[model samples]
Target: MKSATQDKRVFTEQETSHYIGMSRSFLRQSRMEGLRKNRTQAPPFIKIGRAVRYLKEDLDQWLDSHRKMHQLPHEGGAHV
Candidate 1:
């Protein structure tokens, strides 16, 4: 059994931003852009009426999808 906090499946925008290390405004802007573009620009979210919520699993997946490997110095840039 898990505690309520530990079992939380939905999070508010602010909580998602903090959990993902992004600013609230950034998330907001992304959502706005997504609306105008008719595409999702940020992590998947749920719209519960006027509130936006993010799932922990979705956030984790989004972060994983965005993972990048750092380029070795010799692998990029100067050929000299």
Candidate 2:
């Protein structure tokens, strides 16, 4: 079996923000707060020196976990 990191698609902070449809600052704040609170509810990321990156597979899983499948359209569920 291959490790999760192996063959993963890495994205820069800017790219991740765009891919996730969130602001870069929001991503940074989420990471900072998650680290400060030692919480695991946020999406996973990697920090190398002064740079940060997110894995495409990880982001997909995170988004899936947060997805709302039963909510009405007006209940703030994503419109598809």
**How do all models score by TM-score?**
0.71, 0.68
Error of 2 at 32 (Å): 0.7
User: Model 2 compared with the native: what TM-score?
Assistant: 0.68
Backbone clashes in model 1, listed as residue pairs? none
Backbone Cα, N, C clashes tallied per candidate: 0, 0
Q: How well does candidate 1 score on lDDT at residue 46?
A: 89
User: How big is the positional error of residue 29 in model 2, measured in Å on the Cα after superposition?
Assistant: 0.6
Global CA lDDT computed for model 2 = 0.77
Model 1 poorest 10 in a row by lDDT: 32-41
Cα lDDT of model 2 by residue, 17-58, tens digit: 777778888887877777454544557998889888898999
In candidate 2, residue 38 scores what lDDT? 52
- Badly placed stretches (over 4 Å) of model 2 are 1-8, 35-41, 73-80
